[model samples]
Target: MDFVKKLPRTSSGHDTIWVIVDRLTKSAYFMPMREDYKMDMLAILYLNEIVARHGVPISIISDRDSRFTSRFLAVNARGPELVQETTEKISQIKDGLKAARDRQKSDADKRRKPLEFSVVIFSAALHGWYYMVFVTTVGEEYDKVFNHFGYVKCTT
Candidate 1:
């Protein structure tokens, strides 16, 4: 599980795409840009805004856009192939995520039947058995912790 960020052009200007992912949990946020921003400004934005909130990630991956690689390039000479390769890599990541999510849901559904099994196995115990089964079978809702837009709303 790695974190990846992408800069996509939005209606406002160039927006930063922030992706935070764990094994089965994933969240994406689109952050709009301020005026006259540079690559250094972006680094600061990533460090202060994104990393500060999520803590340091294991790895950070991004496309070879000018905003990411201009400091390494010589004047106007930048690699177009790098951009193409990075774009393809991102697409593959998106597809993999979709598959992982679907599989997780399927497995959860399959495991849910153990609640019914507990009834037969623990027929002598009435009160505590069903309570334990109910708590164990229910997964935490991601929506309660994060919104569709990836903002962390404090429920407490």
Candidate 2:
């Protein structure tokens, strides 16, 4: 959560030490780094020290900085076709039905659930139900779970 431009052992204008941390356990990785460290070198260090030594972790949290956000840094930079494939048709069918179901679920939780709205609610529920059944039937047809409710996919 903290970064300093200068360290006592290093020169005044040398590389920054990118600090990563696990807040719950208070463990940290002190990495002496320049932002411009090429992709290959960075991958080597990460695999050797972090992945190899410590093993895969459930999650890693980092600051919103260019070093983390750079397009070149992403391992899977999807091609335009793949990106379009995921967004345009693949996601829309799942998302649209989910939005309707969630609204119905919220409405149903109220003390005065509407009697006349039962047909509307049933149709919405069926859409959600069908999505799950289709995904399961198609053998994990979609990578994402239906009705994830704003869940963000972090593939790291």
Q: Each candidate's lDDT (Cα)?
A: 0.55, 0.56
Stretches of candidate 2 off by over 4 Å are 1-14, 57-156
- Tell me the lDDT of candidate 2: 0.56
Tell me the deviation in Å of residue 60 in model 1: 21
Q: What is candidate 1's lDDT per residue for 27-137, written digit by digit as tens? A: 655455644567798788777866788787464455654455545555535589778888899999999999999999999998865532221112122333322222333
TM-score of each: 0.25, 0.29
Worst 10 residues of 1 by lDDT: 116-125
Summarize candidate 2's per-residue lDDT along 70-124 as a digit string, tens digits: 5554755768866887688767988989999999987878755333211111113
Cα lDDT for residue 115, model 2?
36
The residue pairs that clash in candidate 1, if any, are none
Off by over 4 Å in 1: 1-71, 74-79, 113-156
Position 104, candidate 2: lDDT: 93
